[model samples]
Target: MKLLFVADPLASFKIAKDTTFAMMREAQQRGHALAVCTPQGLSWQQGLRVQARVQDIALTGQADDWFSAQPERLAALADFDAVLMRKDPPFDSEYFYATHLLEQAEREGARVFNRPRALRDHPEKLAVMEFPQLIGPTLVTRSSADIRAFHAQHQDIILKPLDGMGGMGIFRVKADGLNLGSIIETLNRDGAQSVMVQKFLPEIAQGDKRVLIIGGQAVPYCLARIPQGNEVRGNLAAGGLGVAQPLSARDQEIANAIGPVLQQRGLLLAGVDVIGGCVTEINVTSPTCFQEITQQTGCNVASLFADALEAAVRGA
Candidate 1:
């Protein structure tokens, strides 16, 4: 099968922990043709089917110089057996536009995983609202009053921008309410933008578990990203220490309950951020930690992902 991965630049990839690279490697081991392109490479000319400036890539077993690419050429997305959208987020206007173009390609009978329409509908931070029973007390608002009200009731709360990634723009307000007003103003842009506020779960000390679900099934292990000293964010990008472990009963329960729904929604792969057994985010776009789980737990996440991709392509 020819698999085209839409993601960040190959030159900048860290093979040690890059999930996309892991997927590519596993697929290559299985003798699948692998190609790559960035979101900028995607194009939709007037009557042409959505296409990309794609490069066929070969994975060399090297540390720094891992992948060597063929010269770029234009190809319709439908030409690939499967198109994996593995672009990391700030899910900004450019990413939004890329999804629309991918959606157009899907209309031309391109097999895109984690379907384009589902990607647009499920913004990582906001997607958790769909499963209130699985998440903690949450509120989305643009008004300072609304945030203050939520803080007053919860006492401890977390505030973050809707489009933030890598734990950026996240603020925790304690019972003392220090800098509460400033945080609200900065996050909401003085009521011009909306922000997500949730009751701070004290179980963050244990770690924020990233439970991966592939093809409507849960991976038995999870990477628990534990926050470093004086840090409230448990994201590895935010300097957290990742410790992979088997899924707890509660984690499995949450995965079992939510996995099938996401699969039905066309999100073949997903990562659910759970702290204290309460879901915080539903990561549909480029959910990661494949290498971390593999290194720590001996679970070959990329292999499982490749298997799912093959099955999906066969079914399609």
Candidate 2:
């Protein structure tokens, strides 16, 4: 199989921890051809099938210099056996436009994992709304008054932008409401944009668990990203300590309820974030922790992902 991974630059990847790299490595080891491109390489001109400037590459099995690549060439997205959308998010306009192009490729018979339309539909921060029973008290609004009211009710609430990633722009307001007004202004851009506010989960002290769902089934282990020092965010990118552990009963319950539904929506892989057994986010774009969990638990996550991807491609 010829696989095209649409993702960030190879130079930017920390191979030891990059989930996309882990997937690529597994596929390559299984004798699949590999190619890659960034979202910026995608283009659709009048009458041409949606295409990308992709580089066909092979993994070198080395630490510093990992891949050897051929020069970039134009290829229709449908030319590959599978197109993996591994691009990370801000989900800005460029990323949004890239999905439309990928969707066009799908019409041209390209098999894209986590279908482009599904990615557009499930904004990581907003996707949890679909499973209210799995989440805690949450609110999304642009009005400061509404946020203040929520804060008043919850006493301790977390405020973050609707499009934030990697724990950026996240704030916590205590019962005293220190800097509540300023946080609301910053997060909502003075009511020009909406924000997501949720009751601060004290279980955050334990860790924020990332439960991976592949092919509508839960991975047996999850990476619990525990906050370090004074940080409130338990994102690995935010310097959290990642501890791989077996999924708790609550984790399994949440995964069982949500995984199949997301898979039906064309999400081949998803990372569901849970704090205190309450769903916090549904990460559809470029979910990580594959290497961490695999190294720690010996679960072979990338291999499992390869199995699912191969099955999906065959079915397609």
Candidate 3:
């Protein structure tokens, strides 16, 4: 099968930890022809179909020189058997426009995983609100007063911007409300942008577990990213140490409840973040940890994803 990955620049990938690179490696090993295009390379003229300046890539085993790419050439997205939207997030206006292009490509018979509309519909932080039963006390608001009230009620809380990734712009306020006002100003931009406020889960010291779900099924192992000294965020990007462990019973329960819903929404791949027993976030855009989990647990995540992608393409 011919596969196209709409992702970040090949030159920018940290091959050692890049989940997209792992997926590409597995797909290549299975003899699938692979093409890659950055979001910027996608274009659509008024009368023409969506096309990308895609490079066909060959993976080298070397970590430093991971891939060799052929010269890029324009091709319609529909030319590929499946297109993986694996771009990392800030999910800004440009990302929104790119999704619109992919949605158009979908109409022209290009199979897109985690459907474009679904990606737009389920912003990572906001998506967890859909399953309130699984989450801790949470509030999405822009008003400083509202945040203050939530802080008063919850005592210890986490405040973060809705669009943040890699734990950027996250703030924790204890019962004393240290810098709460400033954090609200920073995160909400003084009532212009909505921010998420949740009651702090003390269990974060254990780890913030990332459970990967593929094709409506949960991978048995999860990557538990443990926050290091003096850090409250357990995101690997936030300097946390990742350890792979078998999913606990609560993890399985949460995955079982959310997996099928995600599948129905066309999110073929997802990462559900859990801290303690509370569901914290649902990561659909570029959910990672493939290398961390596989290396620690021997779980072959990339191979599983490739298998799922192949099945999805054939069925599509």
lDDT of 1 by residue, 190-222 (tens): 799999999999999999999999999999999
Q: In model 3, which runs have C-alpha deviations exceeding 4 angstroms? A: none
Q: Which residue pairs in candidate 3 have backbone atoms (N, alpha carbon, C) closer than 3 angstroms, thus clashing?
A: none
lDDT per residue, candidate 2, 1-316, as tens digits? 9999999999999998999999999998999999999999999989899999999999999999899999999999999999999999889999999899999999999999989999999999999989999999999998899999998899999999888899998998999999988888778887899999999999999999999999999999999999999999999999999999999999999999999999899999999999999999999999999999999989999999999999999898
Regions of model 1 farther than 4 Å from truth: none
TM-score of 3: 0.99
Error of 2 at 27 (Å): 0.3
How many residue-pair clashes does candidate 3 contain? 0
Instruction: Give the candidate number with the greatest lDDT.
Output: 2
RMSD of 2: 0.7
Per-residue alpha-carbon lDDT of candidate 3 for residues 122-203, written as tens digits (9 for 90 to 100): 9999999899999999999989999999999999999999999999989999999999888888888879999999999999
> Pairs clashing in candidate 2?
none
Which of 2 and 3 is the better model by lDDT? 2
